[model samples]
Target: MGVSVFSLKGKLALITGGGTGIGLGIAKTMIEAGAKVVITGRRETVLQEAVDTLGKNAHYRVNDITEKETLPAMVEDIENSIGPIDILVNNAGTHHKATAQETSDKDFERILQTNVMSVFALTRECARYMLQRKKGSVIMIGSMAGLFGIDKIVAYGTSKTALTGLVNALVTEYSKSNVRVNAIAPGWITSNMFLNAIANDPQRKQQITNRIAMDHFGQTEDIGHAAVFLSSEAAKYITGVVLPVDGGATVNF
Candidate 1:
């Protein structure tokens, strides 16, 4: 019998900012699904540590996606050395916490460059090869900040909102070629960063917990598992959709 549609046995996936947090989760899950995964970040040590934990099926590359000029060559190098990238996860991002009134032009622009522009640069470079093959999946890691409004994160929210638009536009241009573009908007996922944010702020933590229908935060694996399903052939017919992995937070009142 043929392999399961969900199995990613021979696929090569490249995930940006995969050395830690949500990106790391996605890398681990993709490896478990049988895909040979390549994770990229600026920190060589962190990337190597994650590769070690993810075992042999996982690999690491040190590249800063924010350097737009270098992206095309980097993609070529990865494809030449490892394999054709069947899946590209635009997961590298940064967040800024400040009101719109307090957000300087430079701050907003920096967030946009990292979260939106860099994602486009990498996706385009990878898509060039995928277009020739007439097959690939592109997954954007979005955020709850874009799903709805929360105070003090104007720049971050704006960047994430842009990703939804990016997904739709890419699918329109590439879906006919069998290349799929979609996004996963993760809610409050449990991670050291998140815990640290809420550690001393009891009120903030309580407010977040109350808003979640599940009455708790989600795990990084929640986002990872969703990414795997969307990247696999199981989701061949799905494109331009944003799957929320937010523990019902977006739906809660």
Candidate 2:
């Protein structure tokens, strides 16, 4: 009956891509749960807007995740300026909508650099501090493309699938230091991008709806709630798991 286990009070969370969509959703939920949240994105204007909307518990830092070499300094700056990051959400990523044959080598590498390499680089830097303190949580934003498969997303899918392996491997090492590593594989969550596309193509919308057993697309807050649980003491023993925040779409037959 005690809900304190789910509380994120006094915690500090650093979320990448927090200017919009699911990232902003996570920041909102974390702030409501009593955590001080710092969101990062490449767009200062967008980050500023999100922070302003999120009120006092929210902050923003403009940093492109693809800038791998600068991640260390960015982490240090955040630590000194804000506080030790108790939760880190690797949410910034790029998507390439193309078949394997159509996806150029350059395109694939670009996706990997943004989605995989940068995530690893930032994770390593944050893990250094967490390991030293012997406490922290790392959450990677995955996708249904990685969990199953979808057309026109070869490069993006590969990058997300790699996170599963990354989380598993990191857990073996970081768990010893109490630094948990995990990932959240989100389903077709409703967003302006998705809604606009679906509105124009009813057939495509129906196809997606039929796949979801819940008969509806997920909300951004669904993933946000899951992230909160994973970051909170409620999920202290949970790590190395790729939690599906889908509405059973991944299991549909």
Candidate 3:
């Protein structure tokens, strides 16, 4: 029997902030690809709803990634109770819209703590076990804001840009141990939050549409598929790369 490269048949995936949006998208796709998914979020209700939607292959865990001090024990407990996480998705993040001048120190720090520091802490905890096993994939959810100049998101952009550095640094240190670290930078995707933002400012929507080579916003499934590919054995040889899932927006003039 030829093994399928994309099949995650026996794997277990842990996704932070998996209750909604892109994280929920990833959880759904990962389940379809044959992995048992554990989706975590701060709200039990939200997580349960996601699990219910995902059906039998999905499970829910209540977690607040921002509580950095508890992350080590939390990850350990998840691994021991749920399963050895073969894939870890650092999808929990916060977005703050403000220019450098307008961004308050508190706001910047809050964004950093949620988006960057928490991701690092959780990743490190999961990696310790993966390293011992010499097998695992870690996917960081990066943003287009990190790729190019996006106004009014100074703090959010800075935090995302740091993820690229995190991927590179971790790959250098952990790739030899068979733990791959990579990132996926999503394009402007259609969601309630995005729709509201664009509805309020049509000019902003037009500007975004014009830049995308596809001339349209991407879907959540676009990101979900990318996450699955990266986490599967198909990408075993790939690591330390920042893949722009952005409809050529980063390069388009």
The best candidate by lDDT is 1
Q: How far is 149's C-alpha from truth in model 1 (Å)?
A: 0.7
Q: What do the candidate models score in CA lDDT, each in turn?
A: 0.92, 0.91, 0.90
Q: How well does candidate 1 match the true structure in TM-score terms? A: 0.97
lDDT of 1 by residue, 114-171 (tens): 9999999999999999999999999999998889998888999989999999999998
Give per-residue CA lDDT, model 2, range 1-253, as digits (tens).
3899999999999999998999999999999898999999998999999999999989888899898888899899999999999999999888776678999999999999999999999999999899999999999999988898777789999999999999999999999999999899999898764575466668877888888889778988898999999999999999899999889989996
Ranking by lDDT: 1, 2, 3
lDDT of 1 at 177: 90
Per-residue lDDT, model 2, residue 114, is 94
Error of 2 at 186 (Å): 0.5
Candidate 2: worst-modelled 10 consecutive residues by lDDT: 192-201
Candidate 3: worst 10 consecutive residues by lDDT?
191-200
Is candidate 2 or 3 superior in lDDT?
A: 2
Q: Could you report the Cα RMSD, in angstroms, for every candidate shown?
A: 1.3, 1.4, 1.3
Give the per-residue lDDT digits (tens) of candidate 3, residues 144-192.
Answer: 9888888988999999999999999999999999999999999898866
lDDT assessment of candidate 1: 0.92
